[model samples]
Target: MIIISTLVFFALLLIGLDVGFSMILAALIGMVLRSGAGIDPVMAPMTLVSSVDSVALITIPMFVLAGEIMNRGGVTRRLIDWSAAMVGHFRGSLSQVSIMTNFIMSGITGSAVADATATGSILIPEMKKEGYKPGYASAVVAAGSMLGPILPPSIPMILYAVMANLSVLRLFLAGVVPAILLCAGYMVICGIIARRRDYRAREKASWGTRIKVTRASIWALMMPLLIIGGIRSGLITDTEAAGMICVYALVIGLFVYRDLKYKDLGAVFYHAGRTSAVILFLLAAAGPFAWLLSESHIATAISQAILSISTDHFTVLVVVNLLLLAVGMILEPLPALVMFVPTLLPIQAQLGIDPIHFATVVIVNLMIGMLHPPVGLLVFVTSAIGRTPIWSVAVEVLPFLGWSIVVLILISAFPGLVVWLPNLVMK
Candidate 1:
């Protein structure tokens, strides 16, 4: 029944229906077929309401609004300047700056598509002007955007924690090491490609210039500290932190930077509201869908299928990772998490994996999906912005994809790398 419902959901998606509607309808179909499962198809409407009832879910809009405000408020330009000043001396300097800006923006937006649009719009043109292939430039931005959901204050992490009943703080802390590793790894890849392509490097900024650039971005830089500090110190809950950041972004964009105008508020709020509504609706619809999956004993079936092959923890972990990777390739991250996490929780516990560790792996794996097809939103954003062929950009993204898998394998094999920071800080 779960499988049948999932296929229906996919067919609807492929036919151009919105994910939220598709999920709700698919779940409704399942309930109709299995009307004896103790859950009525009629209750589907109620499930939609109850799914988004959690207080933690409020952060979704707040964080998204903050990101929208930052994009409009001139934070993007300041971060770009700071990035170029700091790393422009390196080979393929523009590409390096794109990744660096995305790294900083990750903390601010906690979103991949926003980071890609914000940074890609600015850097992709500059890279092309600097003689880098447009496709390569877009691919770099697409690859770098994956960092958005792996860093602290990530919206996806918040949603994942909300659904998994895991600690948001622990998940935030767990993201630290993985974020750093990815940032460093991406820069290294850019450097190697730059060296091979004979990409020109920029002049190293003078000490005075570097200091000035750093000073300019100081307020923007403080945004992340404000978010992480408030949350880690228990000064605020995650949703409260989201609200604080949105307020903080507004102040900086209005009074501080003065680039965001009073007139812009209407459009900014509208965009945020629209994006948030889509995600929230998907969360609501996925509730009934996930419940139906649970009622179908999908988790038990999957567990049995995996154990039938090998019950060894290591082998089971590999199989689970592959399953998630495949799932991610097909679904966007939010819907994927909402629909799949419940079905996997039992398998995770039986495999003796730490919740935070498993959560980190799941987040990273789904984020990689953003760089893939046929629903790779990150790739589409960059490709559209750079005006490059989508296939060309996708092909250029292959190396990063391969390297990302390596990082995925590392974290999967060594759980402590992900969980250690959370344990130390949140203990």
Candidate 2:
């Protein structure tokens, strides 16, 4: 029953079915076939609706709305300009700007798609004009945009924290060092590639230009600090911080930057609403599919399989990373999280792994999956923007992908690297 149900889930996904509905229908099939094994069809609807009952879930729409406002309000433009001025003098300067811009944008827009599309549209052309290959330009955007979900205010981390019954702030904190590490890895790869390709560096900005650009982006730069500081100081919960972010972005968009008009509110709300609705529905459907996996004891089987090979901590961590990476190659991160957080989270505790460490590893692995075939959202966005073939873009992104794996390994092997910031701050 488990094997057949698993196949149906992936089969539905491969056929271009929407992931949420695919999970729901696949789950219905699982219940009907495995009803004797404590899977009840009648409970599926209840599970779907009830899955989104938490107050923490309120943060999704708020953050989504904030991101939309920032994107539409000229915020993305200012952020990009600032990053370019500050870092575009380096070897592979444009590539460095892409990474730095995405790192900043990650705080405002936690969605990888948002980062990829917003930054890719602006920078891919600029990079190409500067003599970068279209495929490599697209590749840089796809790789750098991944920082969106790894940094604070990340949407994926919110989902994982809620599912794992962990603190949202702590999970956000846990991502800090790894986010820096990933950026460093990406920059190192960017530098090496730049040297090989002889990518030209821009003239260093005059101090006056740097100061002027930085001053112009002051409000944009304060955003992440405001959200993270507010939450870390215990002045607001994640949901409150999100609401504050929404209001702050709106004010900045309407008054400060004056890029967003009152007339644009309707479209902003509509788009944000649609995006939020899709995620909530996926979360709802995931409840039953995940429940079905639990009833079938798939987690236990996988856990036992790992232990059979070896009980050593490093060996187990490696095996688990491999499994999640495999799951990521097929399913989008959210659905994969829905199905397996229940499955592997318990196993993580059983092995004495830290939840924050495990959460960071799982989220990062799935995100890296976003750069490759089948369902890499980042690759598709950048490819379309750069007018490059997805196949070619995928090839160009390989080096960044390899460096990301090294960062993943660092976090997985050294729990202290992942947990120390959160432990220090939260304590």
Candidate 3:
């Protein structure tokens, strides 16, 4: 009865109900139904707040602020310039630059939406000017933006860590190799599509000019290193390191680069605050939902259902991957992670899967969700920024989606790709 009511509430949510209110109402309804059967009401929301009150959650706001600072401070632009110089010699080089720039920007921002917004705003017009179709440009930007949260210092991972009772540091480390592999995979897909379309490379700058561009981008590049290094060496926690990134962005923008002004700080703060609030509320609401999910035996039911289908670990992975992909198409990453990780973690653990690898699987799947139709936030953001039709961009995004699926399969098949770095470094 609790499960049935929960499903009904989620169905209403899917039809345009506000997620926070929908979740709270659904949980409330589920509790009422269960209480009639002699269950309790107070446990769910109490568990929800308890779930969300972790110190790790502080990273969300700091990282959001850090991303805003980097975006407004010219760091993101410099990264794009340097990435373009590095890859512009190849066929369809400009398209390749979109992927590469997202890779670099991901290290600093760690938010896929932010990456799509920042890089797409610049690259969409440039790609169109360079003869790429409007849809294609938006597609590339949307697909490439997945890099931001799949990589290290990923805000989603922080949420997943708290939700699943896993190691945040290990999850951050686990993402490194898969993130690199994901970027490479997308580059290959971009190259293939570019070659087939007879896309042309950008004008090649001289070696000296390329070197100068790299030199200019050095400060921006160093931001990732400092954050990663700080985490690896225990010099600072991820939360403090995010604050460090804000300082880095502020200094580089105001004093070093001289592009970011005092007046700009207000807008950056406002935007970051807004973004942070949405995520925090989602976290708070999911807290109760997750608690109720556990108490209602959803996690056990899922694990039992999977085992009933296949005791073989490999088969279980395949099914889980498909399930997550389908869910990703409908749900946003943070809420999805909060809700699903609790259910899935116990199942994966029973199969002896590494928690870190499972977390990567969860993230990559959610990242794909950010690009698919109807509910794909990244696709919408990219289309809006490019000022193009969403359907056109969705069509253009097809090849990249195929590319993402391929990588997803590889990561699922070989958990080592996701777990290797985290184990090597964190151990």
Candidate 4:
């Protein structure tokens, strides 16, 4: 039954079915066959409702709405200007600017697709005009945009927390150091490339200009601090932080920036709703599929199989990373999270690995997958927005990919990188 269900799921995906629906169909078949009875209609709806009933889930849409408002509200322009002013005097200024902009935007949006779309639209063209190769420009955008999930207030971290029965706040904190490391790693690679390619730096900005740009972007920068600080200070729940950020973003967009008008709000809400719905649907479908695996003891079976191979924690960790890297290449992170995290949680316990560390590693792996070719969502997004060919963008992303893998290995080998911030803050 498991073999058949797995085949059906992949087959549906191959035929271009929506991931949410494909998961549901495959699960339904498995449930019916395993029960040796016709499908129990109550099971599907019950699973979905239970999966989404959590108050924690509300943050997903709130964060989505916040990102939408910020994007349309002219926040991206301010962020870009601020990043350029701060780093434009350095060699590879544009590349450095792209990385810094992604870091700031990651705090605001927490969605790599949104980040790639927003940043690529603005910076890719500018980079090309400034003599950067289109492929390299697009590659930088795609690679840096991945910071969205690795930074705090991330939707993927929230989902992983709920799935693993871990603390959302802790998971959010856990990502901080690793995210900073990745940003630094990207900047180092960018600097090297800049020197080799002789990319020119802009004249240093005057203090007057720097102050003006900083003043303009201060409010935009405050959004992440407010969310993270409020949560860490115990002044607000994660959901409340998300809601407050949404309201703040709306006000900044409609009144302060004046870029997002009342009329534009409808489209913003519509887009947020659409993106949120897809995620919720995927979560709902994943509930049943995950339940089936647990019910059939498939998760335990896999755990036992791994333990049989080797009991050494490092060996097991390495093996699991390889498996996740392969799975990430083919699957979107959300669905992949739903399908695999449950199965791996048992193995995680057997090895006594920290949940927060495992979650961080899983997210980093999946984010890297977003850069891989063929099905990499961000690859397509950057290519289309930058007007670069997918092949060229893929080729250009190779160096950034190598850098990301190095960070992944470092984080995995030293779990302290993923856990120290969480421990200090949460304790």
Candidate 5:
């Protein structure tokens, strides 16, 4: 039954079916088959709704809405300009901006797709104007935008926390260093590539101009501070912090900057809703699939598989990272987290791994999946924005992808790098 259901799920997914529907349909078919074969299937419906019933789940849409508001409200432009002024004079400066912008914006909004949409639209054109190949530009955007989901306030962390029954706050704290490491990795790679290609730097702007640009972006810069502060001070739950972000973006967009208007609200809401619908639908459908997996004791099977391969902590970590990265290439972030968190948490604990650290590494690996061929969401977004072919985008994204994968391995091997921040801050 499990084999049949799993095959059906993959078959549907390969045919371009919505991931959520594929999961749910596969699980429902599994349930029917099991029940007809004289097994009780009463747990199916319960698990389906239970999965989506998480209070943590509410944060997803709020974060999605906040991200949309920020993107449309000119927050993205400010971030681009600020990063550009700071780094754009270097060879391949625009690519650097994409890396820095990803690092900075990741704190404000945790969705990788949102980050890509917000940053790529503005930066891609500038990179092209600055002599970057369109493929490189698309690649940089797709790769860098992944930073958002690995940083604090990340949606994937929330999902992982909920599924693993781990502390979201600690997970958020743990992600800080790894996110910075990923950003630095990308910047270094871009620098080397830029130098090799003889990419010329933009003419230096006056210090006064740079200061003006920074001052102009101060409001935008405060966003990350606000989110981190709210979370650390216990002033707001993660969900509330998400709401606060929406409010902040609203004030900045509709009133402060005066770029977003009443008419724009409708469009922003519609787009946000569309994005939210896709995510929520995935969640809703994944619920049944998760239940099915639990029923079939897939988690036990996974745990046993890991233990059989090697009980050595380092070996287990390597194996798990590779497995998740492969799964991430095919499944979207939410489903992947939901499916694996339960299965892996016991193994992580037994291996003496910190749940928070493990979650950070998992999310980071999954974000890299966003750079993979066939279904990398960020790659598609960049391709659409840059009007480049997907194949071109995929080829260019390889370097960034390589950097991210190395960073993932580093995080997996050296768990303290991820846990250090949480140990300091949460202690």
Candidate 6:
């Protein structure tokens, strides 16, 4: 049953069906085939309904809406200006700006694709004009955007929390150190490349200019801090925080920046609704698919198979990371998370791994996959935005990829990087 369902799922994917529907179809086939063996047909639809019926799930759409509003409301421009003022004096300044801006934007957007699109659109042309190679500009944007899913308010983290039965606040906290480490690593890589290539820095900005930029951008910057702080202080639930962010984004966009027009809001809502629908549908379909796996004991079988290969936790972790990396190269993060997290969650108990730490490892691996070759969504997005060839961007991203992998390995080896903040804060 497991083999056949797996084959059907891949086959549906090959034939161009939506991923959510493909998962649903595969699970339905499995359930029907096993109907006489204590698998009730009614279980499939019920699972789908129950999966998306969470109050916590409401946060996803609200966050998505806030991100969309910010994008259209000129928030990215303010972030770029602020980042440039802060980092533009460094050698390879534009590259540094790209990294820093993406880090800040990741806090607002929480979607890698949006980060790549927003930053790449603004900075890639500027970087090229300032003597940076197009491929390098695109590469920086793609690699830096990986921070989106690693930072707090992360959509992927929320999904992982829901699936793993972990606290959303704890998972969000778990990502902080790892996110900082990646940001620092990218900065180092940017500096190295800039020095080797003789990239020139912009003239140093005065304190007055820095202060002006900071003042202009502070409202844009406060969204993430407010959401995280509110949740951390137990002042609001994640869902409430998300709704507040939406309101905050609207007011800032309309009143403060005055870039968001009332009429344009219709389009923003349309886009947000569409994106939210895709995610919610994936979650709904993943329900029965995961349920079917659990019902058939396939999840346990896979976990035992890995344990038999090696009882060493480190060895199992390395193998799992490799598999997830390979999977991520081909699949987008959300669909991949829904399909694999259940299969792997059982291993946490067997290996004595903390769920939050395991989640960080898995998410980091998949986020890096966004920069990988062939089907990397961010790679394509950045390439198009920068007007660079995909191959060139692919080549340019390799060093950053290495840096990301180093961070991933460190996070895996030291679970404290992921667990320490959550443990301290949540306690």
Tell me each candidate's TM-score. 0.97, 0.97, 0.96, 0.97, 0.95, 0.97
lDDT of 1 by residue, 69-181 (tens): 99999999999999999999998899899889999999888889889988998899999998998899999999998999999779889888988898887898888898888
lDDT of 2 by residue, 121-237 (tens): 889999999899999999999998999998988888999988888999899988889889988888888899999999988899898998999988998889888987999888987
Off by over 4 Å in 3: none
Quote the positional error of residue 196 for candidate 2 in Å. 1.6
Give the alpha carbon lDDT tens digit for every residue of 230-343 in model 6. 998989989999999999999999999999999999999999999899989998999999999899888898899888889787788888999999998778889888888999
Q: What is the C-alpha lDDT of each candidate?
A: 0.88, 0.89, 0.83, 0.89, 0.82, 0.90
Model 4: residue 42 alpha-carbon error in angstroms: 3.6
Clash statistics: count for each candidate: 0, 0, 2, 0, 0, 0
Clash count, predicted structure 4: 0
True-structure lDDT of candidate 4: 0.89
lDDT of 5: 0.82
Descending-lDDT candidate ranking: 6, 4, 2, 1, 3, 5
For every candidate structure, what is the RMSD over all alpha carbons to the true structure, in angstroms?
A: 1.3, 1.3, 1.6, 1.4, 1.7, 1.3
> Can you write out model 3's per-residue Cα lDDT over 318-361, one digit (the tens) per residue?
88888887887777877777778888887888888777787788
lDDT of 3: 0.83
Specify the poorest-scoring 10-residue window by lDDT in model 3. 1-10
Q: Which residue pairs in candidate 4 collide?
A: none
- Best model number under lDDT: 6
Candidate 6's error at 60, in angstroms?
A: 0.4
